[model samples]
Target: MKELKSEVSGFVVSLEAKAGDEIAAGQVVLLVESMKMEVPVEAQMAGTLEEILVGEGDSVAEGDVVAHVREA
Candidate 1:
């Protein structure tokens, strides 16, 4: 399993991947709004999305685990 963490402190603006979705390494899984900018959060490795730990509009800090992925 792999963990996807937030790179910035912000509000979750969108979710581009969901649980059970197959994702490739470096694929954008979500966007975070911080400092009035939208920051993309991407998958670190190819895998199946196992869980989404945060939802749209939720606030998250840097290094927070936002999703989990099972190795493909």
Candidate 2:
């Protein structure tokens, strides 16, 4: 399994992919609000989205593991 980590400290704005969904490299897995801007958290490798560790409106810091992926 690969971990999907947040790139910035922010509040989770939305989830673009759900658990069990197939994901591609660089695809937006979620959106995060930081410094008033929306930043996309992307998958680093193609895989099945295994789990989401954070919900919308949840706070996260940079490098925090937000999700797990079972590599394709």
Candidate 3:
């Protein structure tokens, strides 16, 4: 399993996938509000969403794990 992390510090806007949800590579798994703009965070590989390490409206910093994905 590979964990996806936030590229920068920001407030989470939305979670595009939930645990057990299968997703494709490059899909927007989460959105972050930074610099007053929405930044979509994409999956780096196709996999089942294993866990979400954060929730909407949560604040996270760069290099923080946002979600985990189990590769199909």
Candidate 4:
């Protein structure tokens, strides 16, 4: 499994990927509200989403593991 981490400190605004979902490389997995803007968090590689570590409205810092993806 590979960890998908937050790149900025912010509130989780939305999640576009879910557990068991097949994701493509560069697909937007989640959105973070930071600095009054929405920042999209993308998958680094194509894989199956295994878990989501945070919910909408949850706060996260840079490098915080947000989800896990298993090799497809």
Candidate 5:
């Protein structure tokens, strides 16, 4: 399993993938709003998105694990 981490401190603007969804490496799992900009949080490797640790509107810091992905 791999952890998808946020790149910046921000609120979760949206989720692009749900649990159990197949995700590609570099695929945007969610968007984070920081300084009025939307930053995509991407999966580091292709895998099944197993869990989303944060929801829309949830605040997250840099490097926070936003989700978990199991290698396919």
Candidate 6:
């Protein structure tokens, strides 16, 4: 499984996938809000969505694993 990480340090805005969702290479998996801006967290590769490590309303740092993708 490949990790899907947050690029910015911020609060989670939304999560679009649950465990076992089929995901594409560039799909938007989650959204984060930082500095009054919304940032998208996209998948690194095509796969089935695995665990969502963080819940909405949680704070995260850069390089933090937000979710996982089991490679297709």
Top candidate when judged by lDDT against the true structure: 2
Per-residue lDDT of candidate 1, residues 1-72 (tens digit): 888999999999999989999999999999999999999999989999999999999999999999999988
lDDT of 3: 0.92
Per-residue lDDT of candidate 4, residues 7-66 (tens digit): 999999999988899999999999999999999989899999999999999999988999
Give the clashing pairs for model 2.
none
- Cα error of candidate 4 at position 68, Å: 0.1
Name model 6 segments beyond 4 Å from true: none
Clashing pairs in 6: none
Error of 6 at 26 (Å): 0.8
In candidate 1, which residue pairs get closer than 3 Å at backbone N, Cα or C atoms, i.e. clash?
none
lDDT of each: 0.95, 0.96, 0.92, 0.93, 0.95, 0.91
Cα error of candidate 5 at position 61, Å: 0.7
Residue 20 C-alpha lDDT in model 2: 94
TM-score of 3: 0.96
Q: Could you arrange the candidates by lDDT from highest to lowest?
A: 2, 1, 5, 4, 3, 6
RMSD of each: 0.6, 0.6, 0.6, 0.6, 0.6, 0.7
Q: Count of backbone clashes for each model?
A: 0, 0, 0, 0, 0, 0
Residue lDDT tens for model 6, 1-72:
898889999999898888899999889899999999989899989999988999899999998999989999
Give the TM-score (vs. native) of candidate 1: 0.96
The TM-score obtained by model 5 is 0.96
> What's the CA error at residue 31 for candidate 5, in Å?
0.3
Which model, 2 or 5, shows the larger lDDT?
2
Q: List the residue pairs that clash in candidate 4.
A: none
Model 1 weakest lDDT span, ten residues long: 38-47
Q: List candidate 1 stretches off by more than 4 Å.
A: none
Tens-place lDDT digits, model 3, residues 1-72: 998989989999998889899999999999999999888888999999999999999999988999999998
Candidate 3 Cα deviation (angstroms), residue 66: 0.5
